[model samples]
Target: MSATSKKILVVNRKSPYGGLRSREAIDTLLVASAYGLQVSALYLDDGVFQLIQSQQADQINSKNIARMISAFEMYDLKEVYVDASSMGKRGIQQQDFVIPVEILTTEQIKTLLHQQDQILSF
Candidate 1:
């Protein structure tokens, strides 16, 4: 099937800073979704930090990505899934996220990833 006909999941695992992986993942998600792909985001490990509010990217000379993330809705992106285990490990609560998210258990995450037609990791 074509890309627009398939489900695409963007899996992000990098910290919001110290690298561009998180930014790249968001960029890719926006572009893919703009093309009419069925896109979703799964923030695992440090990736969950990408949704944290009041980030100090400027402290490190890195540009903020909050705006890009907030654009998910305009692009009609699917659900934003956060790993429950990861959040607990990092002491991050659902309220800590700038945008709303659906929490998923490890097993559920596995099933979700398994069901995706395309998996893009960063």
Candidate 2:
């Protein structure tokens, strides 16, 4: 992108089910990317659950977030990330996720946020 383009970061901190925040976060990322914005997504706490492979949203009568997440690459929405502490606390590994993500420590996430011109949390 150009130097004038703002770097946007979308932080997902909610569960995919029982709410719409997680899905909204993904939608935001896709929309931003479609507009040619520099976009990245960071999943923390329960939000990391969205990346779990083979989600069964049918049980909750909700749209499968995995399907939306799977379209990330097609939209050029790269730079997906997860917090290391959260992963350890929840006993989740990279293999447990639907797609490869760059794992970050709390400090690294802070640095990432600092580098962004905008941050949207859901």
Candidate 3:
């Protein structure tokens, strides 16, 4: 990696409306993309819920977070990953997500953590 290139890994470990962490994670990714950094988003634990299809935030009168996730590709962020076990636990399959995401095992996540230039969890 060049000095001007950044390998930023963002881990989203919470629900979108459960707290601010989910939104923050997406926001951070957007900012990183704007700066021309190589950004990767990892959905672990409850974070897998964020990618569930047909999320209706209008029931709670909140903004739709799923749409934000879908915009990642437009921003040139191609490295979206989700924990396989987490998705299974939440009854979410790969088909449940709008974006094509890499399903990762715990070992893979550990390896990615070591490979990243910066790791941010939210």
Candidate 4:
């Protein structure tokens, strides 16, 4: 990683299965990190569902997002975050997810957004 690699924040605000946005967001994150960028991802709104355990994409003939999510750490994409309020609204807890994530309040998310050199919403 370069000492001055750009800090990129990728936001996922849509449901993972509705369309390809959520998956594309994760792909973007991986590519960015692979290029030596400091990449992070924030799951907001229905996007929180993307991290839930036991996703059955096979039933729908789609790729397994949950499995891909678990690979984030291996890709060196360590700054994954979930919105606290969104999780509460959906009745999801940290233990409900397949991988570890830092839960952030909305205000904290805003602060994080401001700190990023680039922001991309998927």
Against the true structure, what is each candidate's TM-score?
0.95, 0.94, 0.95, 0.94
lDDT of 3 by residue, 24-94 (tens): 89999998897788889999999998988789999999888999889998899899999989988888889
Candidate 4: C-alpha lDDT = 0.90
State model 1's lDDT: 0.89
Model 4 vs. true fold: TM = 0.94
lDDT of each: 0.89, 0.90, 0.89, 0.90
The per-prediction tally of clashing pairs is: 0, 0, 0, 0
lDDT of 2 by residue, 1-122 (tens): 57439998999988889588888898899988998899999999999999998799888788989888989999988799999999999998899888779999999999999999989999
Worst 10-residue lDDT window, candidate 1? 59-68
lDDT of 4 at 35: 76
Superposing every Cα of model 4 onto the true structure, what RMSD results? 1.8
**lDDT per residue (tens digit) for residues 1-122 in model 4:** 45447788999999879999988998998888877788999999999999998799999999988888888988988899999999999999999998889999989999999998889998
- Clashes by residue pair, model 4: none
Candidate 4, position 65, lDDT: 88
Worst 10 residues of 2 by lDDT: 1-10
Q: How far is candidate 1 from the true structure (C-alpha RMSD, Å)?
A: 1.0
Higher-lDDT candidate among 1 and 2? 2
Worst 10 residues of 3 by lDDT: 1-10
Give the Å shift of residue 55 in candidate 1. 0.6
